[model samples]
Target: MENRIQLSFTVDKSLLLREAISQYGISKKALTSIKFEGGQIIVNGEEKTVRHILEKGDIVTIVFPKEKKSEGLIAEEMCFPILFEDEHLLVISKKSGMSTIPSREHPNGTLANGIAGYLEKNSSVSTVHIVTRLDKDTSGIVCIAKHRHAHHLMSEMQKAGSIFRTYEAIVHGSVEQDSFLIDAPIGRKDTSIIERRIDPEGKQAKTSVEVIKRFTVNGENLTHVRLKLFTGRTHQIRVHMMSVGHPLIGDDLYGGSLAIMPRQALHAKQLKLVHPFTKQALTIEDEYPMDIAAVLEKATIDK
Candidate 1:
């Protein structure tokens, strides 16, 4: 499949094609790819160079180079609940127990492979670009970009703190505070490849916790909380909650109990961001999954 994007813009003023491209925020790496790789810059239906001079109202069209699909990502048939979709991006609700991407242990049955299959079935580019990801056992919303350009724009937005994510989780004990912030640095633990820990030498990480409800389940104190991320660190929520002496239920990696659930009781419930191409604000949310709902059903809210 031709995994590329074609964008056309009408020049409002006379200028060099390179200047126009710069104003459009086309990165140097993209331009280099278009030049050395397989892409075309057309001016009024004629191929032109970046040095070409343009007149007002001249149509400048750029065909991005085709993207190469990730190696070893075999397309596999699977279905997910699509929340929002457009030409540039899409949001989908993923079920628990599914990994976001393929790995050595779980290669074929992954969200990426399923997305590749979906794209192929729809006659779309099969190259997948996942922008937001969740843990294998943490079910929730995932955002994907259709092309590299969109991915680049989204990365900028994330770095600028324009992208916001909210999660719902059930922890082991009742949280006394209505709202609080966990400002800590996170880094890889020297012991394990998959584990992360709070370290003074690591990068800054912040998470905001707001108590949604206090409850009891099976004579055990349980708290349902809403969490917002201020920084994107590996296992930020799990590590931070554990540091606060309230590990999430069923999160075995962070000293949590596995009595009520077999996986982390965390779900990405909401996302807020501005559309990279349309410049419009977007808010997407997903309902709680059955397992989480079932756990809540057995609980009695504390007065």
Candidate 2:
């Protein structure tokens, strides 16, 4: 069933469009676009322009459109480690090898399918919205919104830099510096699938890396590192690490050839954001996956 939402609020005499933008944290362009689309924004029960002036006691109504569901959305049964859940959102520890959403060949066996099953079994949530997505091979913390409003607000927060994400990785070489920032541009390769390269014409990307431990595994140097990303781009960490000549272990696409591990040794270790409903700060962390942990343990043998 498609869900609907109606919002009612009284505008103050001194309220201006800019004031509303500041309060709502929505771009003027977005607001204007919504108004132009028709029936989205109403002032005193009538369709209004973005420049419409408001008087005291002017009742505003916002009617949001329902998100269209994709056809043939396959549902699958899979388990998600629930880190936290509430009326507004959910935090889960997504495992490696699970795609976040249904794509061409992987209609099932995805995190979205598992989440749908969970919501169906619980029966409390009417809709699920994914605010962030991790790579299929990268495991770690992910956030899901239970409602459209929550999704909108949380996504806005992320765009405004109110959300923070941290990751952990095991790179193939020893990192000499204690900490450093990699500010490189990334773009698609001229001819490649599942590959990205550092290019001058690419989008801006930055990653802060700090070495957590340095050791040897099977006579090969390995460095465990923590990464804090200032900008999120496709394959940002892997590309940046490779650009620095320290590609992550088991990362086949971006240059590391260590096959001891099954998947790329990257994990979304931490996430922080404010609650869309309660406005309280929420922080969550996920532990390292077993495969990566085992590799690290073997590296710690002091060989």
Candidate 3:
């Protein structure tokens, strides 16, 4: 269960070991790690340098360096459902009110700590390489990489816009449009350290929103909406929804009423991506959180 990858390759034609490695999209940084770190490159059962020439049909193997756990992360036992798992990746369901990683304010009882405990129990890699993270108050699926190589590949995929995430939210008011795009820029608020605002000088942000249902609770209008983020900005959905006068329910920071739901009524519902190593399509979805569903069940559908 060591966080090491042993990749085997067959040389179809004559070439240097370095060139063959390049064909597999191995970066120069990985090569450097191999050379300096405790990794190795072997040819036909013998260790060899990258410059070594390889004959046709020769077997090549690359043993990636063993990974180490991040400092200051302590293992803690916490129950979480594993949505999907493999040798390289793990998809976990995160409940609301849990921080993704340990911080100064909350150093333990985090999702990372829980995962570390899980890995320790299994004697797997101790490092918790979270590929996707959610806010402390948000509930949903998070993808974790088992090794650094997998993390690197997932990072590249994210940059290429191949990693897609979908969210579900209950907003304050009934949306006028059934489907539309929220095209705006988001920037840090001038006064607050943790707040964000829609600013013209901010980075571009886009969110596609589609209404799923409209209902009334206690004579208050509400809309359940499905949202897709085209950009990863801090507090983006909260800020964008506020800008359009439809702040999410229970999102007090964004001027949402906390009368119905306690914490921002938002959930990271789904994720879509292609497995970096297996090159297979993956679509993972989390069921609607019970807290949100409970609120919706008390409402009457809007006519």
Candidate 4:
């Protein structure tokens, strides 16, 4: 059953309706959308406009419209490792090789397709609102907002840098420094449309890597790396790591050796964000996937 939403607030001081709405962190776009859907903001049982002034003891109420699920998205009954779910959002542990969204190459069998099936099974009435995304070969936590309001709030948090994400990877060589920052600007490679490279006149990109532990595979040193991204660029982590002479294991696109692993060993291990409606903080995490773990086990030497 969909939860009934009726936000009520009592005026403690005199203020314009628009002022109160802004102070309450309500989106102006939401307000316009509500109006289009016949929902209204009422003050003391009377419908009011944003210009309306409020007095002390005035009761204000906001009504939300019905949730509408997305249409035309292929709903495939595929399995996913769901970590946390609520009425507002879902946290899923995506597996490697599964694309996050649908595209021409991946029209079906995507995370979105699986999620569409789940929503249909539960009889939900909302569209898929992907708050964060990962590359097709990367596996880890993905946040899907169940409604537009939650999506908007979470996006605001991301822009503010309040939604923090951390990744774990197995890089080719043992890093020389314990921790370092890759403050290089990234842009589309001149030769390829999909590839990215560091350029002097590119978008600013920053990534910080920490050396967690060092191990070796058949006498060759490999680094267990933890990464924090300050910017979201196309193939940022992969490109940045490659620029440092330590491309992720199994990632051959950027000159990584794929002798043992088939796919990139990068994993989205941690996600921290505040709940949109509840205002509660949530930190979601998942262990390394089987494929990555299998490659890690190939390490014959540990240092």
**Alpha-carbon deviation at 162 in model 1, angstroms:** 1.1
Q: Rank the candidates by lDDT, best first.
A: 1, 3, 4, 2
Q: What is the TM-score of each candidate against the true structure?
A: 0.94, 0.81, 0.94, 0.91
Task: Write candidate 1's Cα lDDT for 231-272 as tens digits.
Answer: 989899999999999999999999999999999999999999
Residues forming the 10-long window of minimal summed lDDT in candidate 2: 30-39
Can you tell me which runs of candidate 2 are displaced by over 4 Å? 1-70
Native-to-model Cα distance after best TM-score fit, residue 37 in candidate 1, in Å: 2.4
- Per-residue lDDT tens digits for candidate 3, residues 1-303, read 154677888899999889999887678898899889889999999999988999999999889887777888999887899999988899999999999999888899999999999988888853889999888898999999987778888888888899999999999988999999999999999999999999999999999999999988888989999999998899889999999999999899999988998999999999999898788999999997898988878875433
- The true-versus-predicted C-alpha distance at residue 40 of model 3, in Å, is 1.0
Q: What are the candidates' C-alpha RMSDs?
A: 1.8, 4.1, 1.8, 2.3
lDDT score, candidate 3, position 237? 91
Model 3 regions more than 4 Å off: 1-3, 300-303
Model 2 Cα lDDT, one tens digit per residue, 1-303? 223344456666657644654465445554554555332767766776556767787877665454434356655566778998976688999988888898787678788888777866776434558988899999999999875666778878887888899999999888999999999999999898768899999999999999999998878888999999888899999999999999988888888875668679999999988776567888898988899889888877764
- Each prediction's whole-model lDDT (CA): 0.92, 0.79, 0.90, 0.85
Clashes of each: 0, 0, 0, 1
Reference-based TM-score, model 3 = 0.94
**Model 1 quality (TM-score):** 0.94
Better by lDDT, candidate 3 or 2: 3
Considering every candidate listed, which one attains the maximal lDDT? 1
**Which is the winner by TM-score between candidate 3 and candidate 4?**
3
